[model samples]
Target: MDAIPFLPLDPLSILLLFVVGFIGGMVSGFIGSGGAFVLTPAMMSLGVPGVVAVASNMAHKFPKALVGAMKRARYGHVDVKLGIVLGIFAEGGVFAGKEIMTRLRAVYGDTGTDLYVSAIFVVVLAVVGGLVLRDALLNRSSRPAGTRQALPAAARWVRSVRIPGTMMRFKSMNNAEVSLLLVAPLGFATGLLAASIAVGGFVGVPAMIYLLGVPAIMATATELVVAFVMGLGGSLFYAWEGFVDIRLAMIILAGSLFGIQIGAIATTYVREQLVKLVMGMIMVVVLFSRLFKMPVYLADLGAVPALSPSLHGALDALSVATLALALLAGAGAILIALARGIAAHRRRHGMLEPAAVD
Candidate 1:
């Protein structure tokens, strides 16, 4: 293997990474696995190599995920056995994901790798985001606090078709033990996404909720355990391949630790419905972030007509703007929920203290 060229951090880039990391961490904490979706793209925008951006993001994730899992556990939301079972399978998927990335890089270089990752981002985010968003709209209730949503038809179907040898009970789901057959693919996909772009929670959490019948709150919390397991395993593989950038990883991790705590606590205040709504909305918004940049990669690879330099720059700018909006939108929603939660908590206790951001 050869020494990978790590991007030199300018003052501006360092500051940018710190801010992005904090926001990303907050999102991750609340949703159980989102920071990497933003962090990887943000690093790539700063002239970091495609593989290195992903590698560094994965390296930063395990510690943050560990913190998040522990925090959410206090709320009695985590399903440890379920998470561990899923994560072990996810580890295999991570290995497969790295192979896919490395091969793409070797053949078509960074442009190829970026194109592949960006395409997946667009497709996966759009489908999952749209589904969750629609579900939120349809399921709106008068209740303030979130309750476990009714199981989806798919989940019911999955639970009914029990494989005699593969059924395993999970406390997160009410009755029916899901089959290992179903879990294997979902876990693998989660790990694959985690390795590919360091954002597997998007898939893992939703699968647990809509397919396996886990409640939204429990799904988000339990995914952290899966994340911790996969992130640790993925980092070792990426580091061995000389893709991990320690300096970049540490900076992001440092900022994210603080943000993750806030995000985790915010979860306690908000309704579970808001969790799905925010996760879905952010993914839909972030989809544009990738769409705006996809043409540039295609043109670079001669897969599409060449773009004028000015247009290319404009597309990149638009991508960055959308990414920023996604972060801000997520943060704003979490904070609002936190404020409302705090006020409600106070009202119930008949406390005299004024409400404030924690």
Candidate 2:
């Protein structure tokens, strides 16, 4: 097989990558996953091949996740034991995912691979994003201050299941006993999606929350641990195959590290429902972005008529815009929430009072 050549890093390209990386990192730190969704498409837009973009994004993810996980852990949000177990099983899923990508690339080349990836992005983002948004809306309507958010029905059902021999208890999960069988598949799916698109937290966090009955804060924080493990293994696997571009990975990582720190801090200031809100909103916006690419990919595959050059260019531009919008929207929401939380905190402590008249 021929080696994958790295893209030229012009100054403009470098700056764009860095900015997008920072935005992605902020989202990842806040919600526990999503940086890759923006970073991958941004790289591809800069002329990097799809596989190479995915590979390089994975290369950058582990360290960023590690930093974010450490910060969140300080807040007592991380479940180390749960993360480790899920991450270990997720490695198998990574291997399986890599094999699938390899065969797809070998059989169908870059265009076909891109088509497959985009199609999955569209379907998964739409379905999962819609569900999350609905849940967030419901939570917003019914939840009161200082009260814990209610578990979704799916999560309630999951917790109720009792498989005697397969049950495992975790201190982080309120000492609740859940089936290993349930946790394993969720981890595997998380790893599989991460390998495929570099954003498995979409599945991982929600599954932890809604499937395994992990609380949103802990689930989101735990996802960083899962991302770290999966990313490390995935990066090594891709590097061995000569798909990773170290320069790209390093450039993106530089900005993402800083953004991740800010994001992790923001999580402490906001309600759990806001985390779901930001994630769902980003996913929905990202869904539209990927949707715009479908027709173009279809045309490339000759499954649809070729678009005019101008129209194709228009769609491509629209796709990029929407993806960036997803990042901006999420970041904006988090920052606003953080500011409000700070103001409220100050008010409660009488720190917002005007100075006494002289």
Candidate 3:
């Protein structure tokens, strides 16, 4: 068997990883589930193999989620019961998704795995990003995505269904009973996405909000609960397979630990309309990044005619650069909001005891 491709990290790469992890932490803290979407792709951009990137990102995530969950819990944002039940099923999905990755790797090799991961990224981002963008555009400035409380038609329909043995209630859903059958598939998808691309929040948080009548803040916070479960479970399996690089996980986790708290705080201050806008744009931009990567991976797999070294290098650079810019774009919005929010809080409180409202 080929040696695990543990790329020797240089100073610049290590610094970049730290930066990515911090911003990713902010994303998770604020948005409730995503730093991994950016983190795994960023690591891959840094020459880590695709599986390794996902595995290491998983390793760093559980602790960050635990910490983030605790912080948000202080604000009464987390739904532990909902999170745990969904998370249990999500672990099963993680097992299946990781198994799929391993088999693909054993067959078509790293390039194949790269191609598969990039393909999933493109599809998921395109569909989800487009929907988010449309909602942001159509939504009134007065009512942000976060503050809208009335359930969508789908959620209402879901709530109306009464399965005798399968229904469960949640505070986030206003104590309405939702079916475990529905919850299982959603949890499975979240786990699969997390294992495949190192992100479940992209799928989980949004699903909770739009599909299950969850409030956006609660959905995001509760996703941290689900994330904690999946991250810990997935990390064990990845580590057993020798896919994790502990050093990389630690460096990234160290930076993200601080960033996640800042991000979680920003959620209280920042408006969700802007978050939705930036999030949609980031996904769309990253769609292009994966698109740029596909041909390169295809050529390597001999699924396409070979390209000149110059062309291959150019494509690779484009994919990495695009991924960086997309992630940075999202982080920039959060950071700017964080700065403004903090300033406003100090101005209003004058460093005295802060008020009780967001």
Query: For candidate 2, lDDT tens digit of each residue in 44-154?
Result: 767787788888899999999999999999999999889998999899988888777777778777776677777788888888888889898988998777887666687
TM-scores for every predicted model: 0.94, 0.95, 0.93
lDDT value, candidate 1, whole model = 0.88
RMSD of 1: 3.4
For model 3, give the 10-residue run with minimal summed lDDT. Answer: 140-149
C-alpha displacement of 318 in model 3, angstroms?
A: 1.6
Show the colliding residue pairs in model 1.
none
lDDT of each: 0.88, 0.85, 0.87
Ranking under lDDT, best-scoring first?
1, 3, 2
lDDT of 1 by residue, 218-261 (tens): 99999999999998999999998989999999999988999999
Q: Which stretches of candidate 2 lie over 4 Å from their true place?
A: 351-358
What RMSD value applies to candidate 3? 3.1
Per TM-score, what order, best first?
Answer: 2, 1, 3
> Of models 1 and 3, which has the larger lDDT?
1
